[model samples]
Structure formats: structure tokens, C-alpha cells
Target: MRTDVLHAVRLARLDLTLIGRNTTVLVNVLLLPLLMAWFLTESVGDVEIAGVDGRLFVLTGMPGLIPGFAVFVNLVNSFTARREELVLKRLRGGQPSAAAVLGGSALGALALYLGQVALVAVWAGRSGGLVPANVPLLLLAAVLGVVLFCLLAAAFSGITPNAELAQVTVLPVLLVMLLGAPIAFPADTLPGVLGTVSHLLPATPLVEIMRTAFLGGDHVSGDGAALSMAGQWLTALPSFAVLLIWIAVAGVLARWLFRWEPRRG
Candidate 1:
């Protein structure tokens, strides 16, 4: 047990070092999200959406976007690259357990994701007057978002043929996770069928959970009636359940489909 933890930590450190050396990956994983949040916040200005400040609305969505890119997109590329290089195969034959190998590879990305979330939270609090109405719920959403996206990344990596193909394969899931959520508009504002589909997207629950945590139930409930923080948490249960279901599905897919070696023609 202790050995697994140590191995995972060592692997995480190595991954972090590799990320630091790669300027493009570092920028995309760490800097791009901050810039996006800044630009989106600026564009929205002080307008209100669903009775919540637009800047706050955009800021709250960072939990969804950061993890989507840093964990899901980045991990698909990482896993695919390693598989193609035979690194995954070698590791599978070595001392590190599968859990340690996968968890360690994901830890570095998770760390970066968390750091970006903190930076956004601090910026939002100081500049956008975004105060958390429920800190526990906020933390829960962030953790679940990271775990769910990590599993999704692992599952998707199995389908990606190479690092280059990861870029193309990640787009559909990325678009759905980002645009399908209430990032640019309120959840209730999405049109008919689009609204129903958006609610089912993986990132939607995470965004909804964050928005509810930072704003309140009325902001997400769309009824114009304010809900107690407890009520807001209650309303978020469905979103939480959605995340759990995705996690389970992704876990099963990843276990079944993940390849340690590159595919042969």
C-alpha cells in the first residue's frame, strides 16, 4: 500500500517535470484557460444572466473548462503518446501496479487543474464579487469534475490511435462538454431539445454544481425564486448522479478498451 503511494507520487513528479519542459503543453494546460476566462469575463462585463452577474457566471464555469482541457484532452494525448511509444506496455510489465501507473500519470494534470481553479477563484472573488454560498458543495463539484473527466480521458485514449489523432478525437467531447454547458448563457435559455441534451452532458452537472455553489439555486433553477443553500444542494443531486453515472461508464470502458501497446495495422 505504502509502495503504491510512493510509486504514484514519483510518477506524478516525473509527469510534472515533463509538462514543465514542454512549453506548448504547459501553455495549453495552464495559461490558455486563464486567458479564456479573462476574455470571457471582460466580454460579459457586468451584465446579469438569470439574476447572476455574468462575470460570475463565466468564472464559475472554469471548473468545467479547466478540467475538460487539462485532464480529459491532455490525458488522451498523454496516454496515446505513451502507448504508441511502448511506454505503457513497458510500465505494465514493471513494478508499478496499474492503479499507480494510471493515477500517477493523471496526478500532475490534476494538480495543474486545481491550481488553475484556485487562481480563477481568487480572481473572481476579488474582481467579480463571486463569493461561495456553499464551500463544501464547491469542493465536491471540483473533485468530482476532475475524477469524472480523468476517467473519460482514459476511456477516450483507448480510441485515439496516436498523439496527433488525439487532437481530432478530443474535439467532439470537448465541444459538447464546454459549449453544451451554461457557459455563455443560462441553462434555462438553451432551446428546447438542445436544453435537454445539454443537461445530460458530463460537464453540465459540474458547471451547474459550481454555479449553484457560487451563486444560488435561483441562478440555476431558472424560476426566479431564491432557494436556501440546502435547497440548492438538493437540486444539484441529479447533476451529481449524472457525474457518477458517467464516471462508472467511463471506468468500465477504460478498463475494457485501453490498450497498453499501439494497434497493429
Candidate 2:
């Protein structure tokens, strides 16, 4: 047990070092998201919807946007790079379990994602946007977002043929989360059909749940009023359920299709 833990830690450290040394990856993983959040919030400055402040809405959505990109998009590329280079195969021959090896490699990206979550909380709290009315719920939503997307990254990474193709393959899901989800625009701003489609994506519920924690309210109506459709505990249930269903399906696909080695050309 001790040995396994140590091995995982070492692998995590190795990932951290390698990731840290790469300036472009660091910018994309960390700086780009921060810039995106800053631009959107500034552009949409000091508005409100359904009695929930628009600034708060934007802040609440950051966890979904920032971490989704970092964990899912960034790690997909990282995992594919490692696999194409035979790093995963080599690691499998040694002490760490497959889970440990992947977990360790992911530690850096995970930390970055969690750090962004904390940044969102702190920035919102300090800026007087919204402090989470339910801190635990906020944290749960954030953590779940990271986990779901991380699982997705793993699943997608394995099937990606090489580092270059990872960029292309990651686009569909990334687009879903970025453009379709509430990250770029509010759920209410989207047309009904588009909103429903966005709701089906994993990011939609997580953002809604996080917003619920901050706003301390349920569904926001089109006219900027908070509706009573869901109470505190039940606020994010529908979205959560959708995410869970996706998670289950993605997990199955990942398990079935995930490859430790590059496919033969």
C-alpha cells in the first residue's frame, strides 16, 4: 500500500515537472481560461437575470469553463502524447496500477482545475458578486465537474491516434461545453431547443448547480425572476441526472475502447 502510494506520488511529481516546463501548455491550461473569464465578465458587466446578478452568473459558470478546458481538453492531449510515446505502456510494466499511473499523471491538471475553482470562489467573494450560499454544494459541483471531465479526457485520449489529432478530436465536446453550455451565454439567453440541447451536455447542470449555490435560488425564469420549481437540495437534480447518464455512458465507452498503447497503423 505504501509503495503504491509512493509510486503514484512520484508519477504525479513527474507530470507536474513536465507540464510546468511547457510554456504553451501552461498558457492554454491556466492563462487562457482566466482570460476568457475576465473578458466575458467584463463585457457583460453588472447585469442581472431572474434576480440573480449577471456577474454572479458569469462567476458561477467559470468552474465549468476553466476546469473543463484544463482537465478535459488539456489532459486528453497530455494522455495521447504520453501514449503515442509509449509512456503509458512503460509505466504499466512497473509498480503503479493503471489507475495509479493515470491518476498520478493527472494530478497536475486536477490541481490546476481545483485551483481555478478556488479562484472563482475567492474572486466572486471578494468582488461582491456572490458568495456561495451553500459552500459544500458549490464544492461538490466543482469536484464533480472535474471528475466527469477527467473521465472524459481519459476516454477520449485513448482513442486519439496521436498528439496532432488530439486537437481535432477534442473539438466536438469542447465546443459543446464552451459554446452550447452556459459558460459563453446564459441558459435563458439560448433558444428553447438550444437550451435543452445544452442542458443535455455535462457542463450545463454543473454550471446550474454551482449557480444555485451562489444565488440561493431555483430556476430563473425568462423575465429575471427566480422560480420555485426546485428547492435548495433539489436545485440541480435534473441537470445532475443528465450528467450522470452521460458519465455512465462515457465510462462504458472509455472502458471498452481505451487503449494503453497506440493502435497499429
Candidate 3:
């Protein structure tokens, strides 16, 4: 058990080093999200949904965006690049267990994930009026979202033919979560059917969790009408269950589909 932890840590360090040296990956993982957040802030400026200011809404949903770009995109690209370079294939012949290898590979992104969370939290607190009403639930949602997205990233990487094509394949999922879900837009503003479908997305529940945490159920119409769709669904546990289901599904798919060797052209 101790050996496994050590191996995973060592591999995680190596992965972090590689990420530091790779400017493109580093920027995409760290900078892109910040840019997106900034853009959202600029564009949405002061528009309120229900009663929540647009910037605060953006801050609340930033956690969901972090995982997609930081964990999903980074890991999919990392795993596919390693496979193409035969790094994962070579590691298999060595002493490290698969769990350690994969876990280690994910450690860097996890760090970035946490960093993004902290960044959002601090920024929201000072700049956007975020005060968590349920810290435990907020943390749970953030942590689970990171883990779920990382697993999904690995699963997607398994089927990705090469690193170059990863960008194309990854965009759809990212777009759906970022644009189609509540991450980029307020859930109440979406059409009923669109909002319902968006709620089914992985990022939606996490965003809902954060929204509830920050707004403390205050983001409603001043006259006590027009509550957010997320606020309405906050009473249900289905969102958490859906996230768990997706994690399990991703794990199974990754186990079955993840390749140690590169696919033939």
C-alpha cells in the first residue's frame, strides 16, 4: 500500500514537471478558463437572473468549467500524447501499477483543479459576494465534479485515435457542459425543454450545488417569485446520483476501452 502511494506520488511529480515545461498544455489548462471567466464577466456584466447578478452567477459556475478544461482536456491530451509516444506502453513493462500510473498522471490536473477552485472562491468572495451557506456540500460537489470529469477524460482518451485529433473529439463534450448547461447561462433563462436537458448534464448539478451554496437561496425574485430552475431542483438528490452514475459509467468504459498501445492508422 505504501509502495503504491509512493509510486503514484513520484509519477505525479513527473507529470507536473512535464506540464510545467509544455507551454501549450499549461496555458490551456490554466489560462483558458480564466480567460473564459473573464470574458463571461465582461459580457454578462450586472445582468441578474432571478435575483443573482450575472458576475456572481459566473463565479458560482466557474468550478464546473475548471474540471472540463483543466482535467478533461488536459488528461485526454496527456493520455493520448503519452500513448502516441509509447510512454504508457513502456510504463506497463515497469514496476508501477496501473492505478499508480493513472493516478499519478492525474495528480497535476487535480492540483490545477483545486487551484482553480481556490481562485474562484477567493475572487468571488472579494469581488462577487460569494459566501457559502453549505461548505460541506459545496466541497463535496466540487471534489466529485473534478473526479468525475477526470475519469471521463481518461475514458474519452481511450477511444481517441491520437493526440492531434483529441481537440476535435473533446470540444463537443466541453461545449455541451460549458454552453448548453448552466455553467455559461442561467438555467431559468433557458427554455423549459432546454433547461431540463441541461439539468441532466454533469456540470449542471455541480453548478446548482455551488449556486445554492453561494446565494443561500436568496437568488429569487424580490417579490418571492421567479426562483431559479436550479433553486427548484436543489431539494432533489438526483443531481448527485447522476454524477455518481456518470462516474461509474466512465470508470467501466475506461477499464474496457483504455489502450496501452497506440491505435493503428
Candidate 4:
């Protein structure tokens, strides 16, 4: 790595440490989700995910989701906040590439994601019932998903003008995922057009990837639906490929159009 890249990495580590101190990030990353899961377990008490009657599936889904959400929320918020603060301006003036700055910010969130993963694993193991499956694919899908969303968030932030608008800027993407019910329902059962559209969202494939890994036979993925619902097995691959395409296109757009300047300029 270049000296600048190394410096950026160091900066990212420091920031991540500071984030551990920041209550806002701490609450969002750790407290809220844990509380949600505890309450969910109390309310539902041994509910199922796609027929998997175990806490393992629930834990797997929860941990698998953290990175995607963290990448989406953290990278964009941090990037835009720094941009509005002229941190990007100072760094660029000192010769750091946009890539370095972005990577630096992402490193912190990635670290947090990994930490969350470990905690979730411990929690799930202690909870008993169900077991995590296809560990390799689960890990791969998570890393890829994080990479994809971090860039998407940055791309969204690149076009945003100020901190106040960061949440608004991210709202559309969040709302689409929300509307599609990435967390609540199976995407396979969505209306045709809606399902097709969900195919384009970053979280869609990641969730399916998880469903396939953890839920296994119980998994009702769009990929699987293409085979049974439409009698075409090949549709799954293409649909999955679209996510990679989104990653590429969004990454390039983020690199090309992400701005560091205040909008009033």
C-alpha cells in the first residue's frame, strides 16, 4: 500500500476507537438491535424463519443484517458529515485520493461489523436451537454486501449538500428496502413487478444468499422461485448478477461524482 493509504488506515482505526466512545454510534450499533432481538424473542418466543423453528436462524439473520445496515447508515453519514466539515477538503489538499478517504471511513464501520458478527455468534450459541449453515457463503455474501452498500451510501452522500439532508438522501434507498420488507417478508412472495424491483436493491441478493445458507430447504428465494415459479433455473443467476452489476456501476459513479464541497458553493 502507498504511504497515503497507510495513513488513511491509521486514521480509520483511530476514528473507530472514538466511535466506541460515542454514545450515538454505540446505541445504534449495539444497544438498539440487541434490545429489539430480546423483545422479539420475548414477544414471539421461538418463532420461525421460513419454517426453521430455532433461535439459530433468528440469530443468524440478525447478525447477517448488521453489517448491511451499518455499512448503509454509517459510511454515508460519516462521509457526508466529514465532507460538510471540510475534512475531505483538507485531506484532498494534502494529496489523499478520494478512494483513500472513503476507505478510511469504511474501515471503521467494517471493524464494527466484524465485532457485531462475533457478538451475534456468541449470543446465538448461548441461545441454543438451530445452527448457522454454509458458513463460507454467509461470510462471503456479507463481505460483498458491505462493500456494495458502502459505495452506494457514499454515492448517495456524494450528491448530498449537508448533514441535515443525509438521512433524507439515504431515505429513498432505505424506503425501497423498507417497502420490500427485506427484514419482515420473503421477497419471493412480493408482487411480480415489486419483486423484480426488489431484485435491484442491494439487500435483496444478500438476504437471499442468507436465506439459502441458513434456511436451506426452507429458503424461498427469488432464485429458487425462478426455477419453480417460472420453470426457468437460469433466471436466478442473471438476477444475482444484477447485484454485481449494481455494485460496479455504483462504485464507478461514487468514485466519479462523489463531491466534497458544500452545496452553497
Candidate number with greatest TM-score: 1
Q: Distance from true position, residue 208, model 3, in Å? A: 1.5
Per-residue lDDT tens digits for candidate 4, residues 50-152, read 5554344445555535654567766777778888898878987776776677777777667777677667666766766435545665566666677788788
Sliding window of 10 residues with minimal summed lDDT for model 1: 217-226
Candidate ranking under TM-score, highest first, comes to: 1, 2, 3, 4
In candidate 2, how many Å is residue 194 off?
A: 1.3
In order of appearance, the predictions have TM-scores of 0.93, 0.88, 0.88, 0.80
How does candidate 1 fare on TM-score?
0.93
Task: Write the residue-wise lDDT of candidate 1 on 1-265 in tens digits.
Answer: 7887888899889988898899988887788778888888889988987766778878887777778788887788899999999999998899898998988977777787777777877887898676677889888888788878878888888988789889899899877766787786767778899988988888888887887787666545554356797898888888899889988988898888888899887
Which parts of model 1 have CA positions greater than 4 angstroms off? Answer: 216-219, 223-229
Q: What lDDT, from 0 to 1, does candidate 3 have?
A: 0.76
Count of steric clashes across candidates, in order: 0, 2, 0, 0
Give lDDT tens digits, candidate 2, residues 134-161: 7777777766777677778889887888
Q: Name the top lDDT candidate.
A: 1
Pull out the clashing pairs in model 4.
none
**Candidate number with the higher lDDT (2 or 3):** 3
- lDDT score for candidate 1 against the true structure: 0.81
